[model samples]
Target: MSATTLLLVTLGLALASFAYGRSRAYSVARLGGGVRSMHSLPSHYGMMVALWCALPALAIIVGWKLFEPSVVSGFLQDYIPQSVYEAGEKSVELYKNDIGNLVDSQAIADIQDPDKKIAAQQLASMRHISSLALFVLALAAAIAGATLALKRIKADTRARHNVEKIVQFFLISCASIAILTTLGIVLSVLFESLRFFQEVSIIEFITGTTWSPQTAIRADQVGSSGSFGAVPLFLGTMLISFIAMVVAVPFGLMSAIYLAEYASRPVRSICKPLLEILAGIPTVVYGFFAALTVAPALRSFGATLGLSVSSESALAAGAVMGIMIIPFVSSLSDDVITAVPQSMRDGSYGLGATKSETIRKVVIPAALPGIVGGVLLAVSRAIGETMIVVMAAGLAANLTANPLEAVTTVTVQIVTLLTGDQEFDSAKTLAAFALGLMLFVVTLCLNVIALHVVRKYREQYE
Candidate 1:
């Protein structure tokens, strides 16, 4: 049997076990006069039985999967010719790979080499044996566990307690997995960035004004030494992000405030979802709009004003990016603003304050923390954005504050560097990791500042 088929059979058994467990609990309760005499609910007893039935079988399946490959490989090694082994481990590995592929493709009959055909046949036989063994073992384990749990389903059994403990352990395991996964990602990025820094000076990467990352493969080639300066990337990222924030924050916040405080219920209902529809539009579409429409419009307008504007300028990208993020800010801010206690607004009104005054002094203060969080999220979204920038803002690492000029962001360059076949050992490829590390640091700092602001305001509001 296949693993998936076996898994379905196990689950089918568990379902049957649940019904039997519940019936057993009812029978035990009848012996004690009524279900009220039981120590736990019938559902809890059923859940306990289901857990017992599935857990042991699942454990066996997991352990089998982990060890099956190595065990099969070890058994297959005996079939390899002595000459192939003497050729070295690499040659033996290649021979094994060939046999495995033949088995997978079911092409062992087509093989001309007698030894390889025999090896492939053996591999197929072993895989069949392994699957059959697993199916039998898992079913046996499930039946045995369910029978044991069903026998113990007495009126006085603490089935609820056991089920709760199992659930708690599962939740804790999930939390630990998430934390460990994050730690692993950070460590991997840090190690790769360290390798990159070994090749290029960290100071030069951070502070140098030029941002060329092209290193020639040959020593005698022109421009063989590449500049790893990241200042231009940093400035471009900040300039575009700043422009986006300027466009998003005011418009989004004002729209949120009007929706939460001033608009009638009908108007708010109609407008809110319409406003949020902006978020549903894909970023690539926004990129197209910026590149094909907004950028050209800006260029024409600039020409009328006797000013030079690049066809792909940061302003066009930033403006479209801002429009894309408006819904994020508006939706979040609206929720928070609406969540502010009505009693606070009533108190402000009792003090003879107008609606606008009460909103400005009382409602907005209470909602400021959430608004700040929303803005921070939008800013991070802007910084990490790639498609919109790539399509609208041309990839020129120019160190200029002018939004009218073409520029590139750290994310764009990182994507550019890692797009094709790259040697990880080279500084050019490793630079992507270094850039990723810097982006992580920047985002972490933003989170810290947002937290500080949130905590300070939250204390007063609370």
Candidate 2:
């Protein structure tokens, strides 16, 4: 049977087991004192039985799926010609791939080679036998588990405790999967970055000024030696992010304060949703707006002021990015500010303080930690943005702080470096991993700072 079919069958059995277990629990309870003498509720007994029926069957299905391919491949070895094996491991792997492809494409009847034809037929039969065996075994296991659980459903059984333990184990397994996935990503990047540093010095990559990453494949090719300095990328990223924050913080914070503390109910209901619509818009749409509308407007404005502004400049992208992130700051800050206790504001009023004084002294201080968290989230969003930068801020890695000049960011460069069919052993390709490692470190530092700030204010307020 297919895995999905088997799963449906298992679930059907579990449902049946649940109904039977609940009926049995009621009977056992009636024999005592109408569920008062039972150790656990009827629902708990039902849940325990359903879990017993499902868990063992699901485990067998999962284990079968995981190792089925290797087992089948091992069986295919007997049908292969000895000469194919004598060729080498690569040839053997190629032979296996061809067999797998033929099987998957259902072209077994069209097989021209005599040996391959026999092998394909045998492979099909083996898979069918394996699947039939799995179906039978899963059902048997489910039946056995349900029977054992039903027998144990006495008045003294602790069904609730057993169910809770099963749920706890499942939750722990999920958390472990997430942690291991993150660890794997970090270790993979770190290893590749170490390879890159071997080819290009870490000192030169970090400290040098110019930023060109085109390395020629051949010795006779031009620019065989590439420059890997990341200073320009870092400066461009910081300049754009700084501009974005400058535009976002004051506006977002003010809007939040007004909506939370001053605006009437009707106005707040209408304006808050309208403002948050900016966040719902796709980033590509924002990029298009930045490139077509914002960048051109900035250039025209700068021209009127007798200033030279590139068609694609940092200011345009940053401004648009800031506009895009406004909802993040506004919505979060408004929630935190609105959550402040009413009695504290009343106390300020009792002390003859004005509305502004109460907000500045009592409300803002109490909500400072949450406000910092919101701003930190906005900062991270600005730093990680790629579409706006790529569209409005042209990919020229010039190391300048001027907002009117064209520049690129680390993410854009990472995308550029890994864009085409390039050899992974080259410095040009591996530089992406090095850039990723640096970006990770920078984000980590930001998180640490945010944590410290949150802890400080939380202690003072709470």
Best by TM-score: 1
- Candidate 2 residue-wise lDDT, 296-361, digit = tens: 999999999999999999999999999998999899899989988899899999999999999999
Model 2 misplaced stretches (Cα beyond 4 Å): 82-88, 218-222
Q: What is the TM-score of each candidate against the true structure?
A: 0.95, 0.95
- Model 1 clash pairs are none
**Local distance difference test values of all predictions, in order:** 0.92, 0.93
Model 1, span 1-462: residue lDDT tens: 878988899899999999989988988899999899999999899989999999999999999999999999999998999999999999999999999998888898999998888888899999999998998899999989998999889888999999999999999999999999999999999999999999899999999998888886555667547889999999999999999999999999999999999999999989999999999898889999999999999999999999999999999999999999999899989998999989999999999999999999999989999899889978888999999999999889999999999999999999999998877887888999999999999988887887788787877776
* lDDT at residue 367 of model 2 (Cα atoms): 92
Give the per-residue Cα lDDT of candidate 2 at 203.
97
lDDT of 2: 0.93
